[model samples]
Target chain A: MALVGNLRDLKLPNLIQLNCMERNSAKLTIEHAGKYGMIYFHEGQVVHAEFDPDIGEKALFRLLGLPEGKFKVENGVRAPMSTISTHWNNLLLEGLHQLDTMHASGEGKDRRLLEMFMSVKGVRRAAIITREGEIKKGDFQDDKEFALQALSFYEAEKISGLLKKEKSQFITLVTQSKRIILTEYDKDIIYLDIEAKYQLETILPFIEQVLI
Target chain B: MINRWLKEITDIAGVEGVLLVSDNGHIIEKIGTQLDQGTLEQIARRILRIITAHNLDEKSVKEIELICYNYRILAMSAKTFTIITFCGSIRALSLLRITVNVVVGHLIEDKKSMKQIGKYTGQPEIVLEKEYLDQLEIKLISKLQ
Candidate 1:
């Protein structure tokens, strides 16, 4: 029988434990938003795992951090290879610890940067959004909508990478009524909006100054 | 009128050529110098890539400017058409922008003329300038002698 449930109900560690106790050879898959990951098990021991280009312990750790997702385990599946050697219990503990450390490292810094963006003269809304269109922190009421629409700008950012002679420069989009600026802040992506008439010339220097 | 406007744009001090491409990738009209089919194709492809990457659906795109070392290309939508202009130097930057703005304004607001953007009955015609030059030449020659 396939085990199926939301990751919220059965956390990754608990799911791994369930598989381990049964000594089930299976491939467990989890998906959140648009990203997917797979873990291969040999008789209930995690032998391999992947999330895109990341593999082994790193992939496992990332998968561990997903607070909510849909997960499925197909029993009797073959393990592709052995990439994880750490015992599942110890690995889960370490992964959780690492995620906690990562969150703690970024906690206050991102809020301060968002505050900095909102302090700008023409800025009306400031947000720390992920590449996947998740707004971690925002000053706007419709932050989710803004983040979703601003995700289109990622395509622009990538395209600009191919088009710009100054590859290192950040990308900004100006339309008739609005200016959307994207920049790196506190290891997270910062997105801010200002009126179209506001000068883009002043943004970079101000951001750099505030960052310093 | 678009042909004449194209000429006006190409005549901008350092412009190399003017090409008006439709959203469908068709060249609606072309005027001026030094542009070849291959170069135009490359430019079209580059612009298309930019449009795609920017998530700008055709018809929604209002304007685009691509600046390179030797040249600058400006493209703007005019209903079903997108006008593109290529100029040679950074020296033409201000003039080019102003001219493009004027042309776009004319394209949008004054779609009245078949040969010009609008009907301007009072526009002055000055076809003969040889006499004015002749007076200047005579005065300069007299001073020299």
Candidate 2:
């Protein structure tokens, strides 16, 4: 039988641990946003893994950064070749270590982007999401991790050409709960956090003023 | 250590190649897809210029990623070496970040790499300064006295 679930509830470590304890030959497929990776277990030991074009420990460390994603394990699936040799415990520890380091310094804040968000009203949370897959938050107050992921999946990758061709400034998201605004800010998307009630027009002038 | 880092970083899905460059335009090491020494020097010069331009901004020179239509470049600076990777296409940020941090960790944590960094920095430079000339002149005068 195959076991599958979201990464939010079952972290990668637990998933790996459970599979290891079961002593099963399996292939664990991890999905985050739209990207996917596979980890192969031979008799409860992680013998090989891949998130191509990454393989082995490099892929493992890269996959560990997905704070939220999905994972499924297929029993009896085998690895084509072994690419990892370290103990699972040591690998997990090292992967987590790399993840923490990347999180701390990967995305850097641009003051102008922060100032633009601060000058606007009803802005709950904001991040300068880059084309290179980084989120530099405007403030420390709100956790917009989910919103950031959705925005990154859609706006950061697909509409990049659209924004540039038209020279458009930003896009607004109005949902039942909140409003998120996106704009071009120095080769990155400005994911502006706004209250649900506030109209897009209300923040337009402030955005134009500060961004200019 | 540099060889191991190059090997690991190239293992990333879209990473095509990596070059460890010294500040004064030396290719300390190159792995994966090969680039001519001229092209490598050009890139190294540009990286040096950009880092120097943004030198004042706190942490501005730490990491620089340039995305283009065909390929991408990601560069991170250590104490003496700048690690640059050529990517097939830009993907999620985490992959690049992980690769960068891991390479930087190797650049710092490895005893051999640290020693190599010192050796790399010890290369001769032609830069001359008035202060150094004055100091040399004074020493000469003292010897004459």
Candidate 3:
């Protein structure tokens, strides 16, 4: 029933304590820089969460796994150092994996990629646009065109039209440094740019089978 | 009257075709060039499924439209209907939106006319036979698969 202070001043234990003390439905929204995580408390229990993919009590247990009392609780606000750093590398890998799947499916709509990115812990905003100067999909509406222009270096329209047409579901152009993802489905086109340096060469062939 | 009306719609929208379909995916009237009735029916059914599965409610559903790019599909939806238009990689959203609005208005008018026909005739009994339903179902499923 009480409004807790900013999320940055409290830790996991204090958050749990607040849930029990209030004994009411509450939403804990953590905003660091621009990234956000929302945890839902229902009647003194953690019932839902938006950040930790694990969901429910399992996410609570993960949060509690951190060193006890390591988190500072100030005026009912819990602030843990960099939630992204705590799970940085894992999030990066997941982001890469999502990019891979999107590329493989040739379904790099900015919206779908944004959904995947939002599911991760670190990334705040992102988008994918085809090389043809069109916004495919993304989270923030305004930034979509900017990201597409940045990735394409502003020549997306001309370059995308040059790719060969095929019935393969997806058309990919791969190199040692980066990869281009594109797909045609249900009368629309999607595409993306992905860093190829860290991914296995074998991944492209696998994607071809599933996507194309 | 229906064919003439559909042609008028094509003139307004510059689309290749227009279709009148039932909620269950039956194609009642198909008009336009370079488009087969079967293909239009199949596309309609798939679009309906996409709208339903995504829980994309009416408020957020913009006009029903689809634009094809070289590598992806962009789908737009409206209440009770959808349109799938193919666009090459270079099509702009601004142009697509204008085109779709024209088509949407035509669709609304078409739906009204169909209702008026039923009311005027007093038959009000428009039912696809079981055989036609079965055939449509099979065709739709195969197209999706």
Candidate 4:
């Protein structure tokens, strides 16, 4: 039989620690917002992970960041492949540390950054959104469309991992309805709506300034 | 001839690889020997799906530049094909954009390339499944004491 529960009730780190201390080989699968992530433990050590468009350590970090989800743990289920070699203790610590950093820098900082984005000349609107497309703050009339545009960052983040590149600085898209500029700030996606008359390049410096 | 056009983009500094994928996710042409064919195909398919999921295709998004810390992925769309580039340390993106424009122009006008693209016009795209996770579960269950 498998252990199944919600992440809201039991945080992932606690679950990871529980499995590790028990020295059980298990597979913990998490489903959030229609996406699935898996972590495989072999004798108390994390051996593998799989998240859509990500595997190995990258997948582990992403899984760790999930705030809420449904999780299942099947005991004695060995990993098909081992994509991680870090000790469980170290892995857990690192994952938790990254989460802490994101939250610490995220909350109060987003509003200031959004205001800075709006200050840029030729900027029509600015919004800050979570990775799951939730609008944390924005003034856009069509919030749904705005959130959808920000979702484009997920592909960039995935591709960057595949290419072994650094974190993305910004993404610019020229779509039919709007000219958009997007950046990752404190784990939140900050996007801007630009006027048709303003050249994107000319507006980049301001965006860069706010990022700095 | 298509590979030759793609090579122009790969030849640029910081560019690791380039793939010209059809609308339905077929790799019409590619350059950069460092990345394997399977990896390139998967990347192409993933990007195409993302484009469709976000309705970027319907929005007529002409150009997209995903600028990362140490690398970049640039995609330029023509009506029939999209050029996806994996680049490292992009120091001259303007030059790369120009090169892509020229190459895409050539592809649009090239009769042979257009004919090849037409073959894949109505083909269904490959969708990914998560059967590996389930298979692992079954294998482990069978091994239970």
Look at candidate 2 and give me any clashing residue pairs.
A53-B12, A53-B13, A54-B13, A133-B93
Report the lDDT tens digits of candidate 3 across residue range B10-127: 4543354556544444555555635455555545554444333223121132322221224322333444444444344533445545555665566567766556333333211122
Query: Worst lDDT window (10 residues) for model 2 chain B?
Result: B124-133
Q: Write the per-residue lDDT of candidate 3 for residues A136-162, one digit (tens) a residue.
A: 565344333233222222112222232
Residue A92, candidate 2: alpha-carbon lDDT: 87
Interface RMSD of each: 21.6, 20.2, 15.8, 10.3
DockQ of predictions, in order shown: 0.03, 0.01, 0.01, 0.21
Tell me how far the alpha carbon of residue A118 in candidate 3 is from the true structure, in angstroms, after superposition.
6.3
Whole-model lDDT per candidate: 0.60, 0.62, 0.41, 0.74
Summarize candidate 1's per-residue lDDT along B1-145 as a digit string, tens digits.
6777777788788787887655444455678845567556545544443333233222134555543435555666544445677666657566776787787667666454323322322211111123422342233222222
**Model 3, residue A62: displacement in angstroms?**
23
List model 4 lDDT by residue over B19-135, tens digit each. 888876788777774877876776676566545534432456677888775667788887768899888878887899999999999989999988987777643333222332134
Best by lDDT: 4
* DockQ of candidate 1 relative to the true structure: 0.03
Q: Which stretches of candidate 1 lie over 4 Å from their true place?
A: A1-104, A141-164, A168-172, A183-189, A202-212, B1-19, B25-75, B83-96, B109-145
**CAPRI band for model 1:** incorrect
Give the local distance difference test score of model 2: 0.62
List runs of model 2 lying over 4 Å from the truth. A1-212, B56-60, B122-145
Of the two candidates 1 and 2, the one with more favorable TM-score, higher being better, is 1
Between candidates 2 and 3, which one is better according to TM-score? 2
Report the C-alpha lDDT of model 4 over A55-136, residue by residue, as the tens digit: 9987887777765678999998989998999998999888878667656875535654564465456777888877666677
The alpha-carbon deviation from the true structure for residue A206 of candidate 4, after best TM-score superposition, in angstroms, is 2.2
Share of native C-alpha contacts between chains A and B (below 8 angstroms) recovered by candidate 4? 0.58
Residue A166 in candidate 4, Cα distance off native in Å: 2.3
Query: Top model by DockQ, which number?
Result: 4
